[model samples]
Target chain A: AQSVTQLDSHVSVSEGTPVLLRCNYSSSYSPSLFWYVQHPNKGLQLLLKYTSAATLVKGINGFEAEFKKSETSFHLTKPSAHMSDAAEYFCVVSALNYGGATNKLIFGTGTLLAVQP
Target chain B: EPEVTQTPSHQVTQMGQEVILRCVPISNHLYFYWYRQILGQKVEFLVSFYNNEISEKSEIFDDQFSVERPDGSNFTLKIRSTKLEDSAMYFCASRGQFFQETQYFGPGTRLLVL
Candidate 1:
């Protein structure tokens, strides 16, 4: 049973301010964590992924997230927010099947971020 | 970089009618997958395909759903009967062989069951 919980359903931030979207997970094994962003009327784009290589992972468009094993959390952050950063974000965990292959992605309910100009 | 692509960006269908959603995965990728997100709901996995067969499927993938890679490049998801609950944004994804961890997704097809 693998699950991801995004703490906030909606987050409003001012332009040029810092941004944080909290996410926690429950996994039976070492999980592959990912952060994806869905722009309005657009497809999902992978922001970052953590697969035991590095605790701190950098992603596209000035986004990054840290995998905290102790906290069971992978929270997305940005030093400064732009008007374009407003979108829906999802925390995903990959589950490996019996054949030792990554099967499906369990996604969080998602947090919608709104940037105010 | 190559990416997955899906057809019929929007589709409106009557209940009980069959609908086939099409996808064209990355040229060299070996794995294909289908996922759906109901309005304001979490994206859920429907099925995964590899080696010309289904490798795994979720509980949400019931009898009404079927997948096929009829050609070398096309992968399709067919719903035998449409339901109001089936209205959602369906996404198609594909992953390469070596970097099996990352799955690139398509723009998605918005299906509206009336």
Candidate 2:
């Protein structure tokens, strides 16, 4: 079984400060990791994905995350946080099925980030 | 950029009534999926469709749930009997014809069962 755990339920950060949202996973195989952001009243948007290509993946809007195989962690980070960066983030893990037909994502509970102006 | 779209941004219904949530996936996409998120809960996968049939489904997608691609472009999820527990934000997603592609999500439809 594969699962993702987002460490913080709520994180408050000041504008222009560094931002970090911790996420850990338990996977049975070499998994595909992804970070998705859901803005208020908006659909989910993909931040970044790691598909066995690069350990360090860059995403839109100055967001990036590193896949650490040793620690089983894929933590999202940004050099500076903006007011618009406030939103809900989810860590997802995709494991291939038994038949290897297709892969499905298992999402984390989610972390809500609040940016102070 | 192409994206998935869903119908009925929100719906309110009584228990035992049937509801059909509709979605129009990206024009060239081949895989379709349905997911739901209860209030203050994690998003869960319900079912996945390909080639006009169900390729895989989760435990939550039981006999009461059915999916169909009625036309070339529309994919639908029908709930036979709505329950209070069924209330959630339903999201439709689609992926294109490629290996290890990213799934694009819809704005989501909020379903409230009373």
Candidate 3:
């Protein structure tokens, strides 16, 4: 049973300030982790994914996440928060299907980020 | 920059009515998937399709649900009957043939069962 837990349901930050959205996972084996963002009325957009590669993964829109094996964490971070950064973020874990050919993503509850101008 | 596309950005239907949500995945992609998010709930996987057949499905994908790749371009999810609980945003995604290929998502169709 693989799952992800988002530490915060909502986070507020001022523009130009740093942002952090925490996530932790429980998996029996090495996991593929991902971060996705959803704007209001929009589709889920991929941020970044960790597939046994470098621990630090950079994504679009100036966001990044570090996969910490010891802590079982993959928290998203941004150097500065912009109004456009406001969105709901989800931490996802890929559960491999038969033959490891395809994966079904297990998602977290989500963390709503509010950027204040 | 090929992207997945979905039709009927929004749909409203009466209870017990059947509805089909359509998607056109990236032309060269081999894997297609359907997921749904009820209001305030996490997105959930419904089914995954490959080689024109269902490769995997979640518990939420009951007998009333079916998926098909009718032609070279269209992949559809048909729900036999609509219930109030069915109202949610449905997303279609596709991944390339290579291993560990990233899945690209389309703008979802928001379904409302009245």
Candidate 4:
């Protein structure tokens, strides 16, 4: 079984400042982790995914996440936040489905990021 | 730059009415999925389809819910009877063989049962 936990429900950052959204996961196997962003009235956009590749994975919109197996954490971060970066971010963990490993995503509750100028 | 497209951005139906949500997955993707997100809640997986068959389904995908690939290009989810609890955003997703685990989502259909 796999589950995702987003530590923050809301985060506010000033424009051009750094942003951080914490996430943790519990999985019995080598899990595939991802970060997705959903803007207002828009569809979910994939940020990045970690599948036993690089520990630090870079994604679109200058965002990135580091998969720390030691701590069972995959936190999303950005060096500079833009006004457009305000959105709802979800942390997802994927595990093999019973019988054949179809892989289903277990999503977090989501964290709302707010950018202030 | 392929995408999964969904129909009826918004739909309003009465209780006990039936509704079908349609999706056209990205061409060449081998796996397709349906997920739902209730208002202000986490997204939950409903079902996954592949090879013209259902691979796996969640507890929420009961007998009242069924999925089908009526044509080569389109996949649909049918709800036999709409309930107030069925109101939510339904998203269609697909993943190519290359990105076997990275599923891309569609714009989603908002179903409102009254």
Cα-based TM-score, every candidate: 0.98, 0.98, 0.98, 0.98
Clashing pairs in 2: none
As a TM-score, model 1 comes out at 0.98
DockQ for model 1 equals 0.70
Q: Give candidate 3's error at residue B96 in angstroms.
A: 0.7
Q: Assess the local accuracy of residue A54 in candidate 1 as a C-alpha lDDT between 0 and 100.
A: 88
Write one digit per residue (lDDT tens) for candidate 3, span B54-111.
9889998998899999888999999999889999999999999976778889999999
- Tell me the tens digit of each residue's lDDT in model 1 across A42-89: 999999999988899999989999999899999999999999999999
Q: Candidate 4 - CAPRI tier?
A: medium
lDDT string for model 1 (B2-99, tens) is 88899989999999999999999999889999999999898999999988889899898999999999989999999999999999999999997854
Q: What is the TM-score of chain A in candidate 3?
A: 0.97
* Shift of residue A55 alpha carbon in model 2, Å: 0.4
- The CAPRI-style docking tier of model 2 reads medium
In terms of DockQ, the best-performing candidate is 3
lDDT of 3 by residue, A6-79 (tens): 99999999999999999999999999999999999888899999999999999999999999999999999999
Question: Looking at model 1 chain B, which ten-residue stretch has the lowest summed lDDT?
Answer: B94-103
lDDT of 2 by residue, B41-75 (tens): 99999998888788889999999999999989999
Which residues of candidate 4, in runs, are more than 4 Å off? none
> Which candidate tops lDDT?
3
Q: How would you order the candidates by DockQ, starting with the best?
A: 3, 2, 4, 1
